[model samples]
Target: MATVVPEESTASTEVKAHEVRPPRKPSASQIAAARSLPNNNEAVWPAFTTKLPSSLYIDEDRFDEEHRKLFMTLPLPLAPSALLAEPGSFVCRDGFGQSVILTRDKDGKVHALVNSCRHRGSRVTENDEPAKGRLMICPYHAWSYDLSGKLMAVPRREVFGELDKSELGMVKLPCVEKGGIIWVKMDHEANDDFSHVSDELVADFDALGVADMHMFALRKHEVEGNWKLILDTFLEGYHVIRLHVQTVGPLYEDTVVQVDRLGSHLRQTSARVGFTKDILAQNEESVDDLRRVVTYVYTLLPNVAFICSQDYCNMLVMQPKGVGKTIVHNFMLTNVNPQSEKLRQKWEKSLELTDGLAFPEDFSASAATYQGLTTGVVKELMIGGMEVAMEHYHEMIEEMVARA
Candidate 1:
């Protein structure tokens, strides 16, 4: 059954609502820090190269611009129902900070809704609670909306005054699910259609040969850097030899990275290290179990990274927390092994191992880069040849922000 994600369950609605709060007046020290922050206008564009500036890692203004231009305007893709694997399944994503309700309804539709109620604006759903049937009742004002977001009933509309149910339905974002991914435009005009964003997505994810996988394990953490910084960490494998020497460097070819672009979409590929001999000696029959494989890394428009491997896959989603903070979600998956408990355990173990290995390295690099970039030591950034993919990503962002 295809899962329909209701509008409020979308990540964009969740994150934006979460981002909406009374702005905090900066304290004296904070203001001082901001004023003292480096502004190397001359260094903003370095000589022709492939390496981006370390300053970009922590620029306050640039970070703010990204929030307004990228997240607020661009649409991000979500995991599809095929990825959810079953009815009654749901994942409570911390959309930056907003609570987003993602569930497979009884009719097999996926619903992404803001957890807030339409009446008093209180959070209506918790992270894991599932609402069944054709309607969802707000826990706060008892206002109820149907699966399609129509205001079905309110407790005292007739007694107090006839409320306009037609205008009180939950807000819905533009969303479409395919290829085991759900995609939504965050702040598009009401009539904007997002289904045409990707030619490949239009063809369907299953048709792309990457469906039927179930999440084996999911891990998330808070990083003290902009979401772009966290995303950039995964954009190129150039740092593998240096930052991830103890982990990924041992299994990935850090020197060679390839890239492709589709409008705002981007893709990269890196040769998975550690098993060249195995692949050379193995026949087609043994391809599925080989440890080292060519990994396909892709970013769909805004901020999603996916690494599809032979037997399993991994996704790293970057959600912004604020100007200089981000929340990272790492989901590792594999085809559901219906008959073997050992295989399932292996999948779980692989996820734990990968997460434990990669996160510490990424965090340390991102934090250092963030702090270092805050210093006004440089003018322009350099994006060297090795990190061309990352450079392309920044170029796309710059173009979008400039237009916005």
Candidate 2:
């Protein structure tokens, strides 16, 4: 149920029953950082002529380097924070072939731990679903750990001889909950922080009120395409008219969008036909008007894509598997009542539209492009100005990989 302010309230103070204050918009500097190049309505108009190397997308060596240089060193956005609402709640995640456990202990503090048990290195937790219990017991030996990753017990202490329980706790990873999502820097040896992720990104993250949202639905799908290619599909609105004609195209501008870059992250906001019409009619030229009336896609570098609408936040975490495949996790975060059939159905329609379009059209293009590139038929692909975000992304990848 949506919050409502009582009509009788005075101008000085009027609080809604369950209302929440909208999050701050991007700072002026942040906005300037994310601004994209100007583009014509054709959506395919020319801008910069930077050609991405064909091998960059399908090279096996490059894929392995990405795991080490990008995934391992970056502050990755995992699942949303809603999964940790309960004191003993936990969720497991698999990234870069490593298993991780994210838990909220009895103290209501969250911790990220490597899922492997200290004694035998067996996975102490499983992912793709939520789990809750006082102890996360290793199913192999009944060895257990507390939510904070503290060693609790070993079934037969005498059998262990002189082993120290304190020194054998689950390996804790450097993790923090930021922007309504859990972020972990995958370095097991270093005490790295998410400082490099930019305060601009985190400060602007809750713009859609994702911090208070609960998961409406979550799914994992493997697409037959390089992860970068899959992400490229979301960076531009050039294909909306021809590619998404039957679904979301008619509701949005035929061409034209603002693609901004905040550090390495890209925020692309497309003009909505219906909503844009209203703005033109009213002759309203507020600077923030475009943001208030369009769809926003924030591509968080290296992996996560945080898609935002006024009422919904769909976080897509693209986990690269091989040169030819990517594991995509779609997390639907919403404020709607989960138990209400009517509410859920309304929310589900949006997801259905995405699957219908992604599977048959948008994503298929990426997969096909990867196939073509692998065949050595193309030397490189040109990214135009309208798709400036794509160029920005490639450069960031190059810079990060080099820095590492």
Candidate 3:
């Protein structure tokens, strides 16, 4: 079951703040990016245009290559650490074409185990909900395993002569919890080195207090589009003013974003509508109110996009199911849990605005783009200078796929 935060009515008209950790000052790199953001009037088009073949989105061979080389091999973000914050808690996630059981042991160590039982191949956990217990009892034969994937009990063990419990533990994948996200490599033979999750990315997430945030809600979206096409939405701001004009466009500056590359990952910082260069000039050393003026979008290569706003962060894990299908797991994380009615209402409203209104706009655009490409009339898609981030993203993907 989904964890629920208790909401109580408050008599005070003023909003009471929830208990949270101290706000972190913007990192040096983040502050520098903020200072370098171009004003709306100073924004200029890119000097060159890049063209990507439509086959890249609709071709089965291209999709299969990416699936094997990138998605299967890399350390993909599975879920927020907050989801398994409590000891003995577990959550089942099947977004990456694999049923994974994420658990927090009594000692608070996180583990990613295959959901299949060692006995009859039945799923140990039957549903995708946050559950807590000492043992994960398989429904097939009541075979149970501990939170760390250690086999604990088996029914009628004497019936099976010389059963080896030690060798029958659940299969564990290479998992690491960093920057408040759980990352797991899907392929058993893939390299376990997590060097691809760079320190720069962790520092940025740490500065944003991503590790300590409370998970407000998580929802799964089945999008009728390629995963890369869905990711392209967050890589560029060119579509905001045009595509999101009715929803969130009025709050953003037109095509003015500061793009920075952190190894394979990418970070985009853009000023909000009322933002001015003077804000950076006043706060030279540190950005006291960074999210208020600037929106940070970090793309963790292959499958994750972490978008930061003033009150909460949106972590999107786009799992490609096919050339034309993607499963997007959206997680909304807040600095603190909503303890009062006012706070609860505030978060609910934010969730409704983004998930209900804004995200539909972005998702539909990706679907429409996919539909158009599938018709085969358009041989190539044009990438403008303002959307240079998309070019960088695609290049990084191609480079990773080329690796031996």
Candidate 4:
């Protein structure tokens, strides 16, 4: 492990960390909602029906608009903070066709920068080269930039008239580390705000100890489907029995879910089919009990999903690749292993089972839906009453796109 960097006077770090509050336990009502889902069988629904136009998924112009107006403008979720554990650690990603680099500086602050060079617009960091806190030198013209995005060297002085290096740094985006994940607004302008995301919801993520957990795997898979098609799997339980019958079918119920909306985000907790009769018989269950007892699927609308099970959490970032393609980046996190071999194998087997069985089912279904959409059978998508979260997701996308 690298030495922890000291906190500095950086604006990005100061603004995010100051207002965060300690996490509070979930209320009794939340516990009841999770536990009683199978009993009541009623999912929370929106005020009106949501009908999604088919062109939103198939048309190239709408897809491009979604990328520019929604993805670039919204605070999009990226990798876990664990990936940047060491100072100078960084990750490269693609945002709406722009190559982005998220790096943690020596002062323990994370920054998002456009990866192109300031002089010739060439990439600063090569895929094979190390891109730590050291200077990022452009391959095209040898222009170098420091970790704080300041130009350091231009090679050969007085080449093209008088030039100031201070104004020629990499393009900086507004990025903040919160809820154990890093979020960046790629097209952030002055006075940009992410206050639409509720503080209580962020605190809910904190209660899960997302930042403190160890990240075991980071996998990226390309789905041959519209981004919204991929989100349906994360937002609804209705497809589990049909699409995931062989993999995770035995573990979850269909059409029975507890839905909660936190601003643009939504949480769907379904009663596990495997919840034994023994656990429910206990007289009193604690506030933190439902998480371990039920299956939770949270969709941070626009482009992210976090699914939590008994032993592990899988969070995903869906980036639009084209009108009918999406790149899904997922991070799997779990508790650190115990000293004993038996306990170690328990977590190991669970993660292995999840990796082997669950994800393939999801990706295959996404591809199937993508191919099916090209058939032109359905002109619009009908969001049923049971799939309320999916309805909420579609509505939110329309609202944002309409305003944008």
Lowest lDDT block of 10, candidate 3:
1-10
lDDT score of residue 210 within candidate 1: 47
The best candidate by TM-score is 3
lDDT of 3 at 257: 70
Model 4 C-alpha lDDT per residue in residues 1-404, reported as the tens digit of each score: 00001112223332233223233465444555565554424434334456777787788888888887887777877677776767876666764778887888888898888888878788877552224657777878888887778899988968767998878988898888888888778773624587756675676677666776667677678888888887777777666666666655654554366678777777776655445435644422432345555666778768888887644577878888898888888777754424445444555566555555676677778788778778899788777666777767777788888897
TM-score of each: 0.75, 0.86, 0.94, 0.83
Higher-lDDT candidate among 2 and 3? 3
Over 4 Å off, model 4: 1-24, 27-51, 126-131, 158-161, 188-190, 274-288, 337-348
Worst ten in a row by lDDT for model 2 = 1-10
Q: Candidates 2 and 4: which is better by lDDT?
A: 2
Writing each residue's lDDT as its tens digit, candidate 3 over 272-346 gives 665678865665443326766677888999888888876678888898889999988889998787777767787
Clashes of 3: 0
Best model per lDDT = 3
Candidate 2: C-alpha lDDT: 0.70
Candidate 2 per-residue lDDT over residues 33-147, each given as its tens digit: 3233223233445556779889889889989898888888887887788767678888888867788899988877889899899888999977558888899999999899999
For candidate 1, give the lDDT.
Answer: 0.56
Model 3 spans > 4 angstroms off: 1-13, 282-288
